[model samples]
Target: MSPVFSASAEIDDGHLHVLITGEVDMATADTMFQAVLREPAERVTLDLRAVTFFDSAAIHAVVRLAQQFPGALTVLPSRQVHRVLDISGLGDQAWLRPA
Candidate 1:
């Protein structure tokens, strides 16, 4: 079955806090992308604490956002997501973290 992904955003300390839930894949990446794009904040923190699975497309979405926003993207990913990011060579980026 295809995994589901959902995101919610809030403003905190002058930053955008995005909490992501479920799985992240091609099916759900666009929702996440749009959510972040719509939020008006200088800093964006993505909380992947509830994300159960992440694929290359999801990783690409994040990388692309990072590239677009530069130092404005911060990721708080679960251990599995963190491993995927590390394996995908996205760990070296200044925005992703293992949570």
Candidate 2:
């Protein structure tokens, strides 16, 4: 099993930067979602480059964040994240930034 999920957030100027590491699974996706929701900003940069594991529930959390911020959301995905996004057919979403 991967390490337990962890996340941190900070705001600079009008951008909210969220960094997530460890496993993002059914047990942790909701916590990840709520962490981002707590910081409302004109722009959001989600850094998932350190994610060791990713799952469908985590994908739902990411999609919900995209819906919440739309064009203002940018995701930096790790290899794990990219694989699942590709499998889920969301790899081409406009919010994704090359990782």
Candidate 3:
């Protein structure tokens, strides 16, 4: 089956905010990944409050983004999203901030 997902982005005050919804898995990682990386900004915040599902591939994409931006990535996640991040072993990642 195909992964059900969609992403939208907006720029505000020199920052990029990306909102991702649905399942972020192998099938949807490339688009999601590229969308966030397509533009450069002073900071990038990924809002995952509406994400219903997220897999390891999505986790990897976030990791790559963190590595590329260093202290420039922040993630806003709901409690459910936090569980997914925790289960995927990113709960303790220093750069993965919750806001």
* Per-residue lDDT of model 2, residues 6-98, tens digit only: 899999998999999999999999998988888769999989999989899999999999999989999999988998898899989999876
> If the candidates were sorted by their TM-score against the true structure, best first, what order would they fall in?
2, 1, 3
Q: Is candidate 1 or candidate 2 better by TM-score?
A: 2
Q: Global CA lDDT of candidate 3, please?
A: 0.82
Q: Which residue ranges in model 1 land beyond 4 Å of their true spot?
A: 1-4
lDDT of 2: 0.90
Best by lDDT: 2
* Candidate 3 residue-wise lDDT, 37-81, digit = tens: 888788998888777777788888888888887898888876667
Model 1, span 1-99: residue lDDT tens:
744677899988769888999998988888888888886788999898788999888898888889878888899999889999888877777887756
The best candidate in terms of TM-score: 2
All models: lDDT?
0.85, 0.90, 0.82
